[model samples]
Target: MSNINLKTPVDPKDAYVLVVEDNVSNFVLIARLLAFMGVQKCEWKTTGWGVVDFANTMSRVDLILMDLRLPHEDGYEALKQIRTDPHLQNTLVVVVTAHGSSAEMHKAREAGFDGFLSKPLDADRFPEQIKQILNGEPVWDLGI
Candidate 1:
């Protein structure tokens, strides 16, 4: 069984987060932002493929930020695997897609994403969104 540290529940500074995105630039920006916010634990996955298996190897995962359009499998498929996992049931998964349309957002919400954020993510506001998510608050910004 994977060990999880809950002394600081949902606190970004103490949380382990996974980012599933194919774009390196996007991932770098997100990692930097999280680092700036004092988040020390972070993981990266380029595709939704085997995401669940990958997550299983982690000692703990407080949150998952995923992108829809990927190289192989898509975010929805990965999300399905994550949602079905008993271990990751409480792990927050947010959709961070470039197609930040109303339709896509609605689809993500319906598909069971805990939160949604449109891409071309604003550096200034991204940290706040992450903070809210870490604090058990929902952020469904389309970046409009």
Candidate 2:
């Protein structure tokens, strides 16, 4: 869970970011990037299973960077649950998966993802990207 802080955002460094990825190494890299950007509050959830339930346990959820592939249900299913929840209906959700492709990006967009970011996330660009997303700017990149 995260405190997105979109409207009159506090600061990218202080935003609540939730990353749902099954890969430890990938999560580590993302964590390091978030830390580098001075993001103090970041949470981790390994799978799509019970994502909404887990998020309900958090104080706030500003953004969710979800992986498409997971041990349990896929990101689409998780996103569906998120959209259906009244508390989380307005939350920002983005895709961060290795399987970045035109078709996949289109599918994600059609599925109602707020944004799309391809992985191997660029450490240099990720912070700025987060800032843009938090500021309600569109950030749909194909990891190019």
lDDT of 1 at 20: 99
Stretches of candidate 1 above 4 Å error? Answer: 1-9
Question: Candidate 1: TM-score?
Answer: 0.93
Inter-residue clash pairs, candidate 1: none
Say which candidate scores most in TM-score.
2
lDDT tens per residue, model 1, 14-131: 8899999999999999999999999999999999999989999999888999999987899999988888899886688899999999999888888888889998999999998998
Minimal lDDT window, size 10, model 2: 1-10
**Poorest lDDT segment (10 consecutive residues) of candidate 1:** 1-10
Error of 1 at 40 (Å): 0.3
Off by over 4 Å in 2: 1-6
Model 2 agreement with the true structure over 16-135: per-residue lDDT tens digits: 889999999999999999888888899999999999999988898888999999987999999999989888877899999999998999898888888889998998899999889888
What are the lDDT scores of the predictions, listed in order? Answer: 0.87, 0.88
